[model samples]
Target chain A: MHGDRLLLGPGPSVPYPEALEALTRPVLGHLDPDYLGVISEIGDRLRAVFRTANALTLPVSGTGSAGMEACLVSLLEPGATIIVGVNGYFGERLCEVACRGGAEVVRVEAPWGSPLDPADLLAAQRANPQAALLAVVAAETSTGVRNDVAPLGPELAGTDTLLLVDAVTALGGTPLEVDEWQIDACYSATQKCLGAPPGLAPVTLSPRAVERMRARRTPIQSFYLDLGLLQDYYLASPPTYHHTASSTLAYSLHAGLGRLLAEGLENVWERHARIGAMLQDALPGLGFELIAPERARLPQLTAATLPEGLDEAVLRKRLLTEYGIEVGGGLGAFAGRAWRIGLMGHAATERSVVTLLGAVRQLLG
Target chain B: MHGDRLLLGPGPSVPYPEALEALTRPVLGHLDPDYLGVISEIGDRLRAVFRTANALTLPVSGTGSAGMEACLVSLLEPGATIIVGVNGYFGERLCEVACRGGAEVVRVEAPWGSPLDPADLLAAQRANPQAALLAVVAAETSTGVRNDVAPLGPELAGTDTLLLVDAVTALGGTPLEVDEWQIDACYSATQKCLGAPPGLAPVTLSPRAVERMRARRTPIQSFYLDLGLLQDYYLASPPTYHHTASSTLAYSLHAGLGRLLAEGLENVWERHARIGAMLQDALPGLGFELIAPERARLPQLTAATLPEGLDEAVLRKRLLTEYGIEVGGGLGAFAGRAWRIGLMGHAATERSVVTLLGAVRQLLG
Candidate 1:
């Protein structure tokens, strides 16, 4: 019954029909040549979607969070300095994971729902010139704010510091250029804009990031996320046995990526933007106030404050139980007072926007 | 095209039809109440399969190796001593991961195709009385060896050390009694004997193991795999958001567990035993020599030496390309000289054995 609910949440947007169909295909062994061909196709399609020529691009075998951990644990060593921009819940997690990896974390703070200032992040990097990585969430899903990764990339050019970006909600729904922006490591999830289920984290690491991982002082603390070993299994010839990669999920992802590329990446982004603007334009008229600043807002995810006197939880429950529309509740600083409406991938359609608006308007009236 | 091939490798055995059908179900948000119901059902079923009543039973988001890392990193802090039994590849990985977590590791060695003697493992534990955990692989997929776990459990009783098991290949295909065997922490993969696609790792921790994790001196290093945080997300009231668990994979695993339970656990186990014995009985006459000793061999996976002067890789490829049957080439020490044939879960049938033996008989002739 829940499967029939229209998913318009912070993640797990409605998956592509092709992806769902692909999942029903019979299982294949991880090392099966045909499965390997599928894996290779996924890699190629990922590179095109990620806009990178990096050979290390492949899906990490967990959710988006695993991708985040994979990039950090693979790059940061004990005593390494990492500058993290904190504007939302995921930004705070970056600092937490980095600190756990024994990295000295320097925080560049921005208010919730506000975009991080790239200048401030650069200043933090200047203060800690030996910083090994400068990380930012390209589109913060928790607050629907888009940090300007483009400004920070050129600033750190030719420096030892790697510019890492978390593009969990941005990869296919918005424009993300990994090589053009000089991002050393970038990770995205399949559930949001990629039009797939929430199981695989498609990640790409630049040659420099791979080099940094290989020159690590200590062995990567987490063997499961070790980039070197993962690369050996995913990219190397005569692929060595690592963990059994999920061929079932890989098939689904391959189908999702194929569908996205077939639709043209720009067209997908344009569709999300057009449909998202339609929702954003309608929210204030329905007594909801938009959270993120206009210029920095992510079109794929819209965060808005609840109408005055509206019991947020009660209204959300009513929408799900009565109207069968699922949206995300606020996270961190915005909890209980905000709702995150997602227009991602296959869910970004005129019908989704109209249906959601009609339900909210009726509830408000 | 590879989807139709018989999966008789070390893992990724043929998935159940119900599980495949479950994958076609529509995607659901991770936090949906109905989805949560499915999660709870999965937990209950996993507890039944693991034969434990531990409240912390749940699936870790990644593969079985992630489960292995989760157990090791959660309980072992820097300077802690762990005694590991290394007989096959997975056992060596246990030492590798524990070492990466900064634990001082003491390894108990055994030959590639032999089981670790319980007396020797006990001696190692006694020598390192301060060991925080003693780990072993219940079913070593690499060499088809089933380490004797029953004896070590009673011997470690009342000791400070917790017993951890890698049940990646042992869970549903063979007999694994977590509570009865006194296993403090155990982990298994879905794709192997569970008749599901490779993605989720069903892991269960005993109350004592949870206590050990809670008392850890250092924070669990891997953020994605931190057991306490994962428990908070999977089992806590009004569940906290940790990672977006893949509902698609969960559905598949849920259906797989459903089929297994419906078949009756004893009946499923008997099927595997009978099918495995049939294959093992016929291998010697077919010019293949069984690798593991009779008492220690796993019923689900049988490792065997290839006929003398026969190229293993060429013959295996012929079986795959010509007969649409997949048998694994040996791993580690057995590489190039042996093959690993799996009779697990849905693939454990007399028909599978007969088809495989007939194919081999023709190929050899």
Candidate 2:
């Protein structure tokens, strides 16, 4: 009766059993030839997944938040002028990390369920022409709006300002052209659409980003997140090991990315869109309302408002406790207003979509 | 004949099968009651392992290097003065990370295979009395020199300067008295003597360190290594889930730390000592010379000068290819001359020690 259960959470979703097995594989030294071979494969996969020819593509040995920290701090040195696009909880978080890095941050604001217009962000950049870096979230998981970074970077074209992005939830489930978009430094986590366990963060640096880091007036204020030294470890010849990456994690990410590549990136995105469509269409029938505007929605994720009288916390508890189905309630500004349902990786399936809808329908009945 | 050959490297050593098995255990959500309980228990065990009564003990979701960055960057602000003890490769690394945090670094030099004489370091501190922090490695794994951090702080007692210690190779294998020594901030990794695979770093900070961070005029420049926000995330009532922890990595570390605790910290350290003693005593018989003075020696690790006429790299190659054993060659100052034999974690069994001794003997003949 119970072989496996579908994972339908905002994140920390279920991984393929093969990915789980990758965690148990015999641990090898970080610098061992066999492990380096695995790491080399990881770099290629990270580049393909990031969709960049950037030579600095590799995993940062930390979690999703670490990814955010690495990208922001390494790209913008202390006192560097930057514009942070704050639309959701994650964007606000970017502002915090950027502020901590001693950047003079100018926040380009859009309220929680709304996406910032790329044109407005460009206007702010023009007004604050001293801004050397522009940061945005390609997929704002907190509010379920997939900001289009591709067109946004074009407006910053011909300017020395580098475009950085957080693609933590969008890599496999959504189409992101890092090169085509002219995004400078981008980082992502393994837990979302990759279906790998959470730990390592994949990151890339455009030549412009690397060049600016070299020319920075101040050292990248973090040694660990300093891409300057990290480049020595991850991108240098002989591939000097920086941090001890649990080689086991790279194995799982390798396996997860393998599955995604086999499935074809386009098909993976299409699958997410279809499953998201199914859930989005069915949730309204169960008396739920989608949070973000339909046009700007992320295909792999959905944020829905609870029915007028239903207790959001109570229903979330009941879903986890009674049904073993997991989901995320609203975060930060949207607290008590929206439930985030993710159709990431192995969780993006017709069965999962139908089952979650069925479970909510019965609960509503 | 078919059993897996043992790993006796500097780190990522062969973990016990049980430890590897823990990695495959189904991962629960970061906030799952069961997972949180395990994380809490690991914290308790780490405090015991670190011999710290500090209230801020917890694991950072990164490697030992991350632990290093977490400790250094948390309280260090732009323009802070820090004195770093640089003896070998890792100490130089510490200086680099600290300098990147915008600290004016004063190097307290100790020769490779020699401990940082407390008197010399004290003189440096007295000269730089306004230094905000003092950083030293208790166990300098690069040179197999275990410095006495025990007395490094006594001279600066009652001063405002915080004592920072890196016990990456010392935490579970050597004597570390964080409370008795008045260490304000200390960080350790999981892979070295802890018997866990390398992934997360368990760090502890005294109230003084927290107070320092709280009073910082500038923000902790590195966001990934920022301890202030991480403290709120790890210690918040009903822990705020910031990043999805590698639940299995945490679980495996819990199991390793649990087993280490059950065996008792004193006994686990004694085990490393006894096995290391066997390797150290047998080195002369293999025509290898011990590097560090007996009194300054790290009992869990032995650095031996390669035999004349033997290319250390050649021997290491044969050892890994033939015996499936991996040991470290010297880095930086000692490179091409010495080999580092580690009796770390589950790899420190008497049988493995005797086996390695015998292998070196055979190769020598």
Candidate 3:
């Protein structure tokens, strides 16, 4: 396992030594005064990363998907109208969770490799004026398409409709101005560009979103994800105890975010952008074509449609066995037709890019 | 943060070096052939510890509460009737999750420190044959009551109703005969007897429960927790991908369970029982009163009612601040009236027992 080195998948990229060290640090009670200090720092740090000064910014105990559910379930009560943007697997999942939470869901469809057209969203607003929330993915990991959250948020701003963003693959790798974009509530996963272990989801809730949660006609539909109660515990001045947090994992995530900040968020983003471009440029030499548009592509995740006569899974296996580098195969509809190469967090290193390019090149050759 | 060890109340117990070392092991893709081998081994090991040969068993990538949700949501759909045994916080939580998942929940109530009665459960079943499930906690960590699961499980068996058990604190600390007791489904956390870090819940579904899931009218309430879709990925014969598993944690859990088996399950259970009794016997001299009856006490967790006029929290703080040992303060109505001492999983050592007793005695003096 030693030489296994870093994980270069779209999610749960290899944790740095600091993150791993945090995991090994002595345990702390979730509500201990000393641990509350760490939790307070974490809240401040998440706000900085989330770019939200929203009072309710915090991390949920589950993974990135939990953050998504937290945002959706808390805002949309049973039988509430919500418009969900669907471009890939995760967006489809958002619709499912929203429906399960008892929302009268309406889908605004987009192709996998393309970003959502804002006009379509505006039209949905026109059609469903009673819609209480608009949920969209900022970075669609399944397709490597980064949606333009900046404009969508502002367009939906003046209205009472809250904006929920899934930044699972977008955070740290790119700019997410939660405040500037006017994101009502947005969720991100630690496993992505944070280069930490999975188990925590960083989420931010705007004042408007908080009000909506308070005004819920029915309970959030899931106790594990009820944001009202969770925020009361995570965002209080001294912080209240809600659940026994995975304190060890929380510490590891804090360390990972520390390293992310020390490297400087902008520079980290640039490094991923540069390395992702290198991989993108090199893949064509091996007969692979880009699955997403250049402007819409996420720097941390590059989706490549498999070339004719090549099997996506076999290529992924060959990369792992022959090169000792792990990459992800396509998910959902892209299965066997595409490969997802993640340059996330610590795995965003130039060396990882070179190793992955070498593996794909050799396998195709 | 080196000496930052926490008095983790009841859970997220201080793990051993082996468990921490397992976490730092190299990450593996959840679908990695090597990882699958480890997963299979872990499944078998859990089945052995659970004392059942149930083919469907694996860890869900959430906390103890998620395990509760998985067992309930998978079997009981909206409008279904179920009888829940509530003597503590977690049992009441089960009632809530059941309600959220849309079950018409009825509770068989018991006071804190008192074990749930089998007669009360039998009467509930006779009263409500429409009830599709009976949920109970084998070890109520919140109140320190160990119920008669052996009789309660059989009392609900053979009918259209299923038996669901929550064994988060009981798994490694006591003997659980799933087949012998006819438990339709059971879920437990890793931080307990398995000695793994917090995160990931091991759960098993009996053949009867699986049939119930298969017969569900609507998809299980939550997509992330839909065991039907997840079992495909976990089962070896027809392999599939469910979710991005926490590879590092899985490795850690596998390593921990391996060690648990090597120690021999029965011996481990007996060791905890012996230590618990020894510690309980020493408490009367310290002005602490036994809250749980001797016949129905939990070996892994002991609740001691604080002496009148003695502050339970201050004494707990004294143990942690002065001696660097953590004991749990009371929860719910028991707050300020009791302290919980846990001898569980890897922490069930004679050294832990001796250290805890000594610390308590010193605090009392």
DockQ versus reference, model 2? 0.54
The first chain of model 1 has a TM-score of 0.99
Q: Is the docking of candidate 3 incorrect, acceptable, medium or high quality?
A: medium
Candidate 2 residue lDDT tens string, A1-365: 12133457767778867788788777787767777677788889888888889988888888888888887877786688889899998898898888877789999988888888888789889988889888998889988998868787777878867898989998888999899988898888888899888888888999888887788777666667767777887667676657777877888888888888888888988998998898888888778888889889997889888988888888887777667787888888667867999999988999888778777877777
Considering TM-score, where higher is better, how would the candidates rank from best to worst? Answer: 1, 3, 2
Report lDDT (CA) for all predictions.
0.93, 0.82, 0.82
lDDT by residue for model 1 over B61-173, one digit each (tens)? 99999999999999899999999999999999999999999999999999999999988899999999999999999999999999989888888988988899999999998
* The best candidate in terms of lDDT: 1
* lDDT against true structure, model 2: 0.82
Residue-level lDDT of model 3, residues B108-166, one tens digit each, is 99997898998998789889988989989999988778988898766676677788999
* All candidates: TM-score: 0.99, 0.96, 0.97
Query: By DockQ, who's the top model here?
Result: 1
Ranking by lDDT: 1, 2, 3
> A235-340 in candidate 3: lDDT tens per residue?
6765545566776788888999999988988888898898888888888878888888987988888888888998787777777887777777787778888888
**Candidate 2 lDDT tens digits, B1-365:** 12244677677767766678888776566766567677788778888998877778889989998999888888787788898888877889899888877779999998888888878878888888899898899888888898888887777777768899999988888888899998999998888888888889999999888988988877676666778877876777777656778777888898888888888999988898888888888888778888888888887778888878899988987787778778888877778988988888888888888788777777767
lDDT of 2 at B264: 92
Name the top TM-score candidate: 1
